[model samples]
Target: MSNSPAQDTLAQDFVAFAVESRVLRFGEFKTKAGRLSPYFFNAGLFDDGAKLGRLAEFYARRLVASGLQFDMLFGPAYKGITLAAAVSIELARLGQNKPFAYNRKEAKDHGEGGTLVGAPVQGRVLIIDDVISAGTSVRESIEMIKAAGATPCGVTIALDRQEKATVTTATGPQEAAESAVQQVQGQYGLPVVAIATLADLMGFLDVQSDAALVSARPAVQAYRQRYGV
Candidate 1:
């Protein structure tokens, strides 16, 4: 990256790579939470060294570009565990080695065992993950951070799917999610940061992508209309 990246460079690369990596895909799929999504971003698909390595690089770059301040990073469980580890490692490769920790869904009841592994979670902790859908994970992660005697700072994700509803009829998913993320920030003083949002995705798709997505845009728009905050 250059000293000054182009406007929305992070957003563009994230959307492009996400599409290229197929880590996040658009299809009819059932989520763990049982919501039928027209699109899904499965971070678990980031399993190889190259893909994982690139992902961390992007995450690290975004972090630097974001100017977020935090003593540590936290992932929720399972998927989050891997993301946090990779991003922390990538940051280290950039000569900014920051300690990282993650939780196991089932805790080990033995000596030297605790919910969080690796460095002890201390001071301000930023939660990193793939995306924020309904904000459930964000809320739970906040509680867990407080439980560990640390301050939950902000959330960084590859994307932000605005699922909250908006008041103005013209407001779309982006606006709704912006509202929800703001509420969360106001409630806990923590920000939800993402590389891209619906607007970014739409912007990329509108001019360069296929007519299929262009024609199918309304379903996504409808989803935002119904569920956006």
Candidate 2:
């Protein structure tokens, strides 16, 4: 829970980067949990070559700084596919070469084909993704890693909402005690690391000079108070 100065700075910078890229937008956005959020982070917007390369740098830096050991990276599917590949390339560029693999949404039935692609999953594999929303992707990734006879060391993500997860009940949707990130950590016993979190976004908003962005700070703070873990 204690973040070093460098880590804090990196988080702040990442927030700024997201904003500049228009990947992190301030507006009334409906979440999967059905809560109205003040801001939204869309990692898929890191589309172009330069943006993706820079985004990967942030991920690699945070993972390395966390000191979590992993022999390879596993991207679940869809969004994570690009994230894992880019991060692995960044790590290798930083002189820490590591293999990475990703899963297909559906199993293929062709030459050298299956659900998995790229390097074989082995050893302490780290799951990479954009964020932990419902935690479905992380769960699936863990299952695949174990099936491959690999050990899942931990998970790395771009942002942590840090808000309690929602569960559908007979009464209606209800908030759980722990966030999606927390659920993943507790359920699978793996560390869920992030480059930035909701708290960091709040911090960024506090010092932001943009009149429009600053005006949304109150809404963000209220949302965090209502649902933060």
Candidate 3:
């Protein structure tokens, strides 16, 4: 869970911003994996112009700091569309301009007449997204990038839950040894970077004085101990 000093600072700051923006909430929330999580992070809640722009800056900063060389960016459908556009803008503002593209959920019948929009998929492409749970979006994106003959260099996400990935079998759900992010890295042999993680959230709680925020730490810790990777 250790990060470089720059990454540590950014993760802390991003966690604070997320809390203030109400994108991250501490409570009993149901996860897609059917677990009751102590906290929830909704990237879609970063809806306003200022908030979205700041979120993009965090992404750009993390990607740039990671030293991952990417020719362009590719965003999967839905959530990623906005992230890719805004991050591309912020990276350009930071003087590392790069072409970015996104896929539509369905193919367009007319006009450009394809699933992909913006610049053509080419070269080493970085996939931007909010987080990896099941990693369905990342899988789809990798297929698209490879279909276009582009190498999927890496993936940059806003947060890493750092919990075990799950699978369904005859007995029901079972936890995997690797988290979703770890699975992606192993399966594709590509690096995965995150701006913040569950560890960073716990770290934030450890240093905070607010009783309300600090009180949630026990539940979060319990959850991590039980299910975190």
Candidate 4:
């Protein structure tokens, strides 16, 4: 479904915020998958309290706008922990208080812990993260939720790259690949919501009068044309 006018504005505003925060950068950068990308978004840059708080606001807004209902939020190890905590706080501020949880990378052998922490995993749970380059994190989270007898209803992320995903087949590998977001939805039958996308970033760049941004637009567009879903 298409976003409403208000949602579109918020998405654009997020792109602006990302640029100002230097979280979204335009340049030549190699991805984990070994592809050189024109632009890169590093959620790890939102490290300070103020930056994290503002980032959470964008996530909360997108989640509410998505109309996806869930009983709780689950963040994976590391980055997911911060994202889940911050988003829960923001959601509460937006009048939707929900429990949040996270897991340790290794199972803790002491204290009140096994692997999971925070609220008990129950009902429909939403997994929050910075991005989904591969489906591995999401798969791990799904297993954890099922192990706890909780249902994983959806996933929320800061941005969607919308690039083609490579997959193994019986013969060799599938040349026709789906995007990471598409793979998650197809495999799990759950919605993946993002505050912004590559398309939105390109749109933002398109309207800018800055010489650098204007010059960088074609590179990003070319990358999208080659790999976008």
lDDT for 145 in candidate 3 is 95
Instruction: State which candidate, 1 or 4, has the greater TM-score.
Output: 4
1-229: candidate 1 lDDT, tens digit per residue: 2223443777777777887888767757775445566777777787899998888888888888778888888998877888899999988888888888888777788977777787898899999988765567788888888998999889988776666523335553233445556566777777777777776676666665576666656666665566554
> Which model, 3 or 4, shows the larger lDDT?
3
> How do all the candidates rank in terms of TM-score, highest first?
2, 3, 4, 1
| Candidate 3 residue pairs that clash | none
List the candidate 3 regions with Cα displacement exceeding 4 Å: none
lDDT of 3: 0.94
Q: Report the poorest 10 consecutive residues by lDDT, candidate 4.
A: 167-176
- Residue-by-residue lDDT tens digits, candidate 2, 37-75: 999999999999999999999999998899999999999
lDDT of each: 0.75, 0.94, 0.94, 0.92
For all candidates, the clash counts are 6, 0, 0, 0
For model 2, what is the error of residue 202's alpha carbon versus the real structure, in angstroms, after optimal superposition? 0.7
The lowest-lDDT stretch of 10 consecutive residues in candidate 1 is: 165-174
